[model samples]
Target: MAPRKKKNASQIGSVSDNLPHNMGPVPEIIKSEIPAKALKEEPIDSPLPDSPVAKELVTPAKVTPETKKKAHKYKLNYEQSPFPDHPLPTPEVAEEVHRLLSKEHGQRKAPTKVPPPSATKSGCGEVPDLLDALLRTVLSANTSGVNSAAALQGLIQTFGAVNGSPNWHAVSQVKPEDITKAIHKGGLSVVKGKTIKNILSIIHAQNVERRDALLREKVTGEPAGVLATSHLTQIQKDAEIARIKENPLTMAWIFEIKKDSEIIDELLKLPGIGVKTASCCLLFNMQRPSFAVDTHVHRHCKWLGWVPLNATADQTFNHCDLRLPSHLKYGLHSLFIKHGKTCYKCRANTNPGSADWKKAKDCPIEHLVDRELTRKPRKRRRIEDSDESEGDSKVTSVKRKSSGSTVVKPTKKAAKITQSKPVKATPSRPLRASAVKARAQSSQVKDDSESEVEEVVSEYDE
Candidate 1:
């Protein structure tokens, strides 16, 4: 079927240039008002008189399709794909109309601010339990799982019972000055000391019943903020995560199916969170699959030409989400940050360098990843070759000595006996070859010991 063209931004139709010198012979009223000196011819070298009609040269353009198209001043949308061979879907007018109407209706009635994170039953999937979520969040920050697990185990061993959830007093009992005893190995205790206290405080503020209320309440109003209290340890959402979670332009905002402005207001109400934090949180927590581009992510995305160089972090994230895949968004966010940190050129904030920018699959993202799912580790290719080569090399290196011992057929036990036979009582000065054999034996022993440690199981009170 011939593709129907909707109105593009091309100029409607070319109007003739139709330039004329005189419409009414320089109007009689202007002639009457002219002074005699003004009517006199002016000298070219003299200061020119202030004439009302000071004309500048403008060549009349020709009227061909090319000229007409140029005159109309049409250019493709910057975000639009420009390859003429690859076409995109034309938007349905009815759907477009419905979208516009829904937007208009929302604007007319929506609140100026996001109501509190009213209690809701669903979101972020069957989300991790609160405590588990916090552990994951904290563990995820600037560290690895093995270390984070070590820290959590340490905390549990000291403070909590066998089940590991701390009682209110369990948290309160840990002296602020000595909180390091609980999280020292964590290496994140510099700030985590306060985080522990904060969690305890929330525990205090939210009695089991009140906690339920907070989680379930659908009330749309001002947020209570990260509920802080003297009785509580005072852990609120950090300023960073809260800010990113609140962006009006964020997918969460869209998911909330509310006005962009509404979600932004609710996010700002968070104690520590700001715009950037809210934006990030909205994508990460809400699973809206946004780019959630942070500072590191912002620099790298643009350098790869996936986005404009001048874009803000949020813009970079939005542009990427639009262009990249769904499963890949979060991975892209984390990987970009990792890549930015690892590859200096990608993160060059002040002094720039040329990046060997690769595009997305079509070299579009211009890097190993733009969205998270784009990154897939390469498969090991040389394993079979390595095994074959190693076997061949060993066989080749084993030459029959000139002493040319006869190949004697023997039963397995007899062959083993011959191989294990002791050398004759030759008087030995310390042999360098023996020392090498001894060193290899000792190294093998150490490798076995280390492997045992890796496979070690705890003999603990169950």
Candidate 2:
């Protein structure tokens, strides 16, 4: 193979000119928006720093080389792909959105906002109870924050051994129909109730399997159910610690994995868990850097042109999480939600006539998004009514002349164009009866002359 030639400066410049307008590294203007001073300051006081440089400097001593490789998988660049093409939002747009939104909503402090003690017990930087996170997130689906909270409260009130303790043990024993009646106020009670029961059943079954496996290895003589209480005094505590641990392996624990592939597979198998739900669990519960795409995020992503217009919520989630840096995921997710709710211009649809729409036209980020595609409802009017109709007139009725006298304006010439009657096309001239007969006689004479000429030629040839 021949060595490849290096491109000339002009050739490189021409190639770049052909690239999409948005395709390039993040612009300097966006970079300058987030100052070096601000980037250095940690939002929350912690052992580790959020800044990429600082994070590398203070890398955890326990993070093995294998863990480092696992982390690299999540840091994959999703913007460019060879096997399959996928569209993703540019870093500059994400940065711009973050900067503007953070100015309005403020940056999210690390040790992400925690739920109440009843909802969660994990301290800052620790993994949350997966079951609690799953149930709470499931309740949050397709409902307002207030309603989901109420539903969660109702479930605890009914199934919890005491008020604050979400006793999964007792919950596992409860009947499905009974669970349904308890969570009736959460909306989609039947579905949610069945989901909760199914999750509990899955956990219980997995726990039983783990216990049976422990018995086979250590407590060989004991029966399956009895192994839960079976004592293995002879075994070294360190030798059988992982296998003999009493806590059952549930889907929540499954999400603790560092590998994205395994975690995704296990999450999708559970009831009511989609890409959004799974990503949320990974971010909040597992303290991973996965980004979830809800309605607000999806709408903003589309408006920012980070995602294609027809991209689904799940596709947006995958595209974003894979491409976005780990540190920005949490803050950007919050900002997207905040901006989507507050920024009228970035909203999915807005009426042009609305006061909010008028105000949003001047938004700073207007140039960044597809401003022309702002959807507005067309005015309903009768076609039978002429444009000149005083009742149907859309513009201002008042007109002023140089003399300072106000007068009611008459309709323009264009207005009467629609009201004017349309003209019919003129008919073509028809051939008269005498003209037709004379034309036919001339044609016969011409044919007879041609036949005589042919006969004279044949006589000459003979």
Candidate 3:
């Protein structure tokens, strides 16, 4: 490498001076000498008035802090629901329904308050374990209370009970077929059994994971385990199992959630749990304020004009949950069920001329409902047979007589056949015994085939 000669100070100064003239003034290389706190305290520079950036820049308005929404302790508020707009029934209407139902079908007292998890005891008045309550609700789906109770009893009898509760863990271990047999009386035994089995399996799996995690933490003094070992003694394991049996399997974890929405969300993650099922658990089991719409509730709410005509049970629940007062939730739910079951006028699928309908008195809330929206009874027609003879040809007629007198004419094909061939006019005479017998046999065979087809159609309908 060659050594470079050093330039004079005057030459360097001359070059620097010429560079500025040729390419505008050179900007100073400023250093940030101010402390971080001082820089933070300094106001930010605004764009120059004549600059394009200034023209594009906008002065921001002073930002005020948003007020935080106060959360409800037990009830959920759906701020922006997708359901159609409709006002909920007035509190007076709800009260009236409750009062009327209480008179008709004995009054029921629902819990008015929900205790904290720490104070809650697993018993009649207190909230039940999540898993137990869920299982009972599942059995109650589309079934009468008596059948659901019977099914629960059968489960307790077969799998055995601990502290008056069925041993769900034992039930989980058995085959789904066994569960089906146990709950056969509840109806939809196969589907209910599978759903229950799936739920138990999921809960049991979660329990095993928790147990393993606890074991790992205790044995290794670390968050995770390095090796699988029987670190917990058999006695300790048995004690934990017994504790689970005494309490609900999911109670340890699920009850930790404080928000009603979170609890409902967690429940909705289960196999057979829907909005209605989850809400039922919240209202009845957790004693939380929730509107759970069943088929009966949905029908009644529609008739009452509280919800839109097209609203589904789930939509009704969501709409009513937010609109109805929290205090009335339990009472309204219980009363609605009672009224639907006992009141012939309000009951679903009630025929107009049925024994129950004929005996039922006027409904208490009949004036409140829109009678036009209710299902009307269908008009039945009476069928009659007629035989007419024209010359030697006999015509058989089957007529259906309704409220109005109208005779059924032959079909187009029959009419066309009659027009195509004209019968000869001849003197009428008594038919031979063999000919009459043959004709009778042919007619009987046709009636038998028609009856067979009608039977198949009815079976399919069922």
Clashes, model 2: 1
Q: Please give the lDDT score at residue 169 for candidate 2.
A: 63
Top TM-score prediction, candidate number? 3
Report the lDDT of model 2 for residue 255: 36
Q: lDDT per model, in order?
A: 0.39, 0.58, 0.64
Q: TM-score for every candidate vs. truth? A: 0.32, 0.56, 0.59
Decreasing lDDT order of the candidates: 3, 2, 1
Give one digit per residue, the lDDT tens place, for model 2 in 90-111. 5765777678767777886447
**Pairing residues by index, what is the TM-score of model 2?**
0.56
Better of 1 and 3 by lDDT: 3
Tens digits of per-residue lDDT, candidate 1, 95-181, equal: 332233334232222123323321111112112233332333453345554555555655666776322333325655567555557
Candidate 3 local lDDT, 283-350, one digit each (tens) = 77777788888887888888888888767677688787777778778777778877887777777765
Q: Give the candidate number with the greatest lDDT.
A: 3
